[model samples]
Target: MTGLLPELSPGLVLAGAVTAAAASLWLLLPRSGESRAARWLGLALGAAALAGLVATGRRLGGLGEEAVFLTVALVAVISGAATIVTRSPVYSAIWFALSLTGVSGVLLVLGAQFLGVATIVVYAGAILVMFLFVLMLAQPSGLAPYDRVSNEPLLSAVAGAVLLGLLSLAIGRLTSDTACCAVAPRAAGPATQAAAPAPSAVDPLAADQVARLGGELFGRHLLAVEVAGVLLLVALIGAIAAVARGEAALEDDRRLAAGGGRR
Candidate 1:
C-alpha cells in the first residue's frame, strides 16, 4: 500500500478520498425506494476512502505502530461515518461509542494517555445519560419508541452545549498554554530573554510516557484534577436529576393520554 501510494500526490489522494467519502455518505443514508446498486457503490466508495486515508496516515517509524494506527483509525472513521447515516438511533449510539473507543486508541498512540483515557470516561458517561434522557422522553403508549418522540428538547440542549463550548474556547484562548509547559523561562538566560524562541520550537522528549505524565498530573496538578472530577460528578448528578424529572412528567402525560388522570 505504501509503495502504491507514492505515485499519487498526497493532496490529490486526500481530495479523491474526501470526494469518495461524500458520495458514499449520500448513497448510504436512508432514502425512499432505494436501489441495490447504490448500496454496493456506496460500499465500494467507502472502502476506497478508507484505503486512501490509511495510506495518507502511514508515516510512523515502525510498521507495527503503523498497523496499529491503521486499525484504530479505520475503526474510528468507519464508525463515525456510520453514526451519522444510520437509520436507527440505537445503532447510531452503538456506532458512536465504538467511534469514541477508536478515537481514544488514536490519542493513546499519539502519546496523550491521560486525554485518551479521559475521552472514553467523559463520553461513556455522556452517552449513558443521553440514552436515559431519550428513553424517558419517548411516548410510552406502546409502539417503537426509537423515533417516536413527542418533541426534541435535546435540540435545545445541544444548542446550549455548543454555545457553552464556544464560550469555553474563548476563555481558553485568553490564557497562554505555554504556562503549563514551564520550559521557556528556565531554558532561556537573562541575556537571551530578548531573542528566546517560543516554547513550540523546542520539542520535549519523553523517556517514559505514561509514568511521567501520570506523576505530573497527580503529584503537581492533583488539586486541579480533583476539581475537574468534582465538576464531572456534579454534571452527572444534574443529568440524572433532569432524567428523573422528565420521567415523572412523561408518566403524567401517559396517564392523561390513557384517560386515567390523577387516579
Candidate 2:
C-alpha cells in the first residue's frame, strides 16, 4: 500500500483529496431538521476544502495578475459553493450574482476587458435583476419545499468530484505537454530555412478590439451570433409571459379569498 501510494501521481492525489473534502462537506451540510452545529461544521469543512483547492493551483503571470486572479477566483468559488448550499433562494441568487461579478473580475485580470464588461453588464446587472424579480414574484413569503431540501446531495458530490477529476487530468496533461513543447529541441525545416515574413505588431490593449471582434462575429460566425440573439429574445419573452401568468393567478386567488371572506 505504501509503495502503491508513492506511485500515485500528484494530480490523482489532489483529485482524491478534493473529492473526499467535497463529499465530507456535502455530508456535513445542514438538512431540513439538522442542528446549528452541523451547519457550522459544514461551513468549516467547506472553507478548508476551498483553501486546499486554491493552494493546489500553480500561480502564473505577473504578481499583480496572480494576486487579482487568486482574489477573484476565491470569491467566485466560495460564492458559487454558497449558492448551492444556501437554503434561501434569495440568498442563493445574491451569491450567484457575486460569483458572476468575481468571474468578470477574473476575466478583466486575464486581459479580456470587453468580455469582463459584458459579463458584468449582462449577468450581474441584467440577469441577476431578472432572477431576483422572478424569485420575489414567485415566492413573496420566501418559504418553499425545494429551497429547504437539497436533491441528492451524495449524488451531486460524486458527480462534481468526477467532473473535477476529469478537469484536473486535462489541465495536468495540457501543462505537461506545454512544458515539453517549450523545452524540446526543434528540428530545422524548410520553413525555418526560408526567410520568415515579419509578423505585424499590434498593441495588446488596442481600442479597435471591439471592431475586430464584431468583424469576426459577423464575418465567420454570423449564423451563431444571430442564433444566440434569437435565443436571448425568446428567453426574455418567456420570462415576461411567466411573470404575467403568475400575476394573473395571484389576482384570481385574491379575488376568490375576498369573496369567501364576504360569505
Candidate 3:
C-alpha cells in the first residue's frame, strides 16, 4: 500500500494510513454498553489525529499558507471522528465544532474564502452553540442514555456496495479530464525572466470551476442554501421555545412544592 500512495506529500500518505487504522479500530469498538476498550480506542484515535496534524504541519513547513490548509484537513478528520466516538455530548459537540472549522479551512485553501467563512460562522458559531445550549438545558439528572442502533447485515452490505460504486465513479470523473488535474505553470510575461515565478498562480481550470460553482450555487443551488438557512433559523427558534418551556415548568413545580400541595 506504500507504493500505492502518490509522491506528492508523505504527510498525506501517513495521515491516510493512520486515519484508516483509527476508523477500523473505531468500528470494532463496542457500541451499545459502556466499554473500557472503546474509551481506550477513542484515546488512541485522538493520539493518531494529533500525529496526523503534526505530520501535515511539518510537511507544509510550519504555519505557512500551505500549512493552514493541511492543518485544517487533519484537524477536521480527527475531530469529526472524535465527535462520534466520545461519550459526552458536550465534548462531542466541541469536537464537531472543531471539525467544521477544519472543513472551512480546507474550503479557504481551495480559494472559496467566502464559502469557508460562511461554513464556520453558520456551523460552529451558531448551530454548535445552539446544540450545546440545548444539551445543557435538557439533560436529565441521571446517567446518560445509551442505546445502540443495530443495522441489518443485508441492508448494510447493499449500502456499502452502493457507496463504493458511487465513490469509484466519483474518482473516475475527477481524474477523467486534464483540466481537473493539478495546478499548471503560469504563463510568462513579456518583461518576465526565463523563469516565471508565481507562488499561487491560478490553476488552469480555476476560473471555470469558480464560474461553474457560482452559476450552480446562485442559480440552481440557490434554493438549497436558502432552505438550509431557514431550517437553522427554525431550529434556533425551537430550541429557545423548548428552553423557555422547561424553565416555566420548573417554576410551576417549585411553586407547587412550596405550597405543600399533596393528594
Candidate 4:
C-alpha cells in the first residue's frame, strides 16, 4: 500500500475527490435516525471533494465562460446529490427541479439552445409538475417508512464512485490527446469531399435547429422516440396506481388508530 501511494498530481486529486464523494454519499444518504455529526462530516467531505475536482480541471479558455459553466455545473451536481439524499420527497422533488435548471444552463453553454430550453420545458415544467401532483395526492399522514432507508446504500455509493472515476479518467485522456482537440487538414485525393469542421466548432445553431432535431427524432431515432414516449406513459400510469394505493393505506391506518382509541 505504501508503494502504491502516488504523487500529489492532478490524477491523484481526482481520485481523492471521487473517494470523498463516495464516502459523503454513503454518510449522507437517508438512514434511520442519523446523527448530526455524521451529517456534518458528510457535508465537509462533499465540500472537500468539490474543491479537489475544481483544482484538477483545466481552464476552459475565457474566464467568464469558465465561471458561468462552473457555477451551473456546481448547482447541478449539488442539487442532484441533494435530490438523492433528502428524506422528504417534497424537498427531493424541488432539488430535482433545480438540478434540471442547472442542466439546462449547461446545455445552453454548450450551444444546444433548443435542447437546453426543452429540457426545462419538458422535464421541469411538465413531468415534474405531474410528479408534484402525484406527491400531493399520494403522500402519507407521516413520513413513510421506505423514505428512511435507501436500497443498498453502500453498493450504490461504490458503484457511483467507480463510474465517476472511470468517466473522469476517460475524459482526462480524451482531452489530453492533441489529435482529439485539433482539426486535421482535408485529404488531397480527387475523390475527397470537403472536410467537415471539428465537432466542437460546428455551428449546429446555424441550421433550422428545431426542424433538424425533429427530423432526426422522427427519422433515424423514430423507434427510440416512440419507446421513450411509451415509457413516460407507463410511468404516469404507475404514479396514478401509487396514489390510489397510498390513499387506501392512509384510510386503513386512520381506521386502525380510531378503533384503538375507542378500545
Q: List lDDT for all candidates, in order.
A: 0.70, 0.73, 0.63, 0.87
Q: In model 3, which regions exceed 4 Å deviation?
A: 1-66, 147-169, 176-263
In order of appearance, the predictions have TM-scores of 0.60, 0.73, 0.52, 0.74
Over the stretch 28-78, how does candidate 2's per-residue lDDT look in tens digits? 543567677777766776765665566557756468867888999989988
Give the clash count for each candidate: 0, 0, 0, 0
lDDT of 1 by residue, 1-263 (tens): 55786788765676576566666766676655557898899889889877765655536667998789888888898898787667666677788889999999999887787788988988866765577578568636444544423233334434533564455345444433645644464635666655655543433323466787788889999999999999999998998999999999999998898886545
- Root-mean-square deviation (CA) per prediction: 8.6, 6.3, 8.7, 6.3
Candidate 4 residues lying further than 4 Å off, grouped into runs, are: 1-7, 183-208, 211-263
Candidates, ranked, TM-score: 4, 2, 1, 3
Distance from true position, residue 91, model 4, in Å? 1.0
Evaluate candidate 2 by giving its C-alpha RMSD to the native, one decimal: 6.3
Worst 10 residues of 3 by lDDT: 53-62
In terms of TM-score, which candidate is stronger, 3 or 4? Answer: 4
Better of 1 and 4 by lDDT: 4
